[model samples]
Target chain A: MTPQAQRDILKKHGLKVTAQRLAILDYLITHETHPTAEMIHQDLPMISLATIYNTLERLVAAEIIIVIDSLSDGKRHFDYYGQPHYHIVNTQTNAIIDAENFDVAPLLAAARQASGLNITGFHIEVYGVNPEDAR
Target chain B: MTPQAQRDILKKHGLKVTAQRLAILDYLITHETHPTAEMIHQDLPMISLATIYNTLERLVAAEIIIVIDSLSDGKRHFDYYGQPHYHIVNTQTNAIIDAENFDVAPLLAAARQASGLNITGFHIEVYGVNPEDAR
Candidate 1:
């Protein structure tokens, strides 16, 4: 996404556009590798780790991004919430592959019926290993 | 479970049957709340936070327990891996309700086909709010 587009998103979410926020949003938009805060900092060394964390927190609160902490590595991975989708996590490498094929609407409905609660959101992560790596 | 029974399970899992380990396991088995380390520490005041964390980590590594980080609260909750089941998270209260009625085998299979990876395990969390609380 262009820097202007990033700024627009930040503004749309009522977040003030800053260089740090734009850099992080741009990185997440450009990279699909669901990265941790530290990973994002490594790529954008100009931004301090604390700044990256604060900016990410704001974006997440504004619903501009989502956090995934279900991976085996026990690290929080952030993904741009452009659309709703599930994730496929590699158990060994901690790599995240977005899997939008599987629809979770049916399962969400089932959970609501079973629990009798007003459903809000859902998180589904399928853990797997590459066949080549397993071999 | 009785103390001896907990000890037996620990031994079976090749873990040493220490008092701290048994206490944590017993607490989890008795309480289905899926508590964080701090919550567990609150219940078992004698056990230090460090020991609770260490024991929980060891039990999770041994497959005797599982760590859930998918809740909106962003705290790691521990559950006994006695059987495979999903969780219903109360977004407002952070309470975890076990929902065993939903079968995820079909979903996992679909993810395997879509990603072409050797599926290992899966984590599913349905977020919701209790109707009474919602009202």
Candidate 2:
């Protein structure tokens, strides 16, 4: 997110734009792949895990991003992508790959008719071996 | 899965249907809601967590069920339902609830057109506080 847009969103979510929060958001936006909180803390060495956790929680509350809750490596992983997307999980290694394009129409239709829910939105995780690695 | 069906799926997955495996499958079928390996161990009493884990791994490989990987309480939680469905998460308490029905046609269409790819299926998890609990 741009500096101004990030600030605007933080304000909208009633969150104070702290350096830590901005940094976390910045990491989320610019980071190429999905990462866990521990990974985030590791990347921003100066930041404490607690701060990352707090910032992520605040971000979720503000609806600025979504927490994947994917424990890729026996640890909880978070993906802060503002847009909706699905993840392909490497169960063997617990690696997370961001999926850019996959149409979920047939599956969604089948699920909706079966469930009868007020599904506001959905977070998806597909646990599987990487196609190439499997080969 | 019954003894016969269980044997069939195991054979299909090229797995050996051990007694432990049968027990785990029985546990999943008769159990209500979704239970992880730890929870399954706790419920079965005599079974070890390791056994549960192995059984779950085998079942997933057999394509009999999907691994949820929902760490509702910072611990990996598994949903054994063979059917495709969405989950309602209580972010506050990290509770998992099964949502019976919701349509994803519009959203799927949007995602499909935006990212062109063959979507075999999708799994959804809505990370939010329960509406009733929120009130």
- Model 2 docking tier (incorrect/acceptable/medium/high): acceptable
After TM-score superposition, the amount by which residue A121's alpha carbon in candidate 1 deviates from its true location, in angstroms, is 1.6
* Alpha carbon deviation, residue B68, candidate 2 (Å): 1.8
Clashes of each: 0, 5
User: In model 1, what lDDT does residue B104 have?
Assistant: 88
lDDT over C-alpha atoms for residue A91 of model 1: 77
Candidate 1, overall lDDT?
0.86
Cα displacement (Å) at residue A70, model 1: 3.2
For each candidate, the DockQ is: 0.79, 0.27
lDDT of each: 0.86, 0.66
| Predicted structure with the largest DockQ when compared to the true one | 1
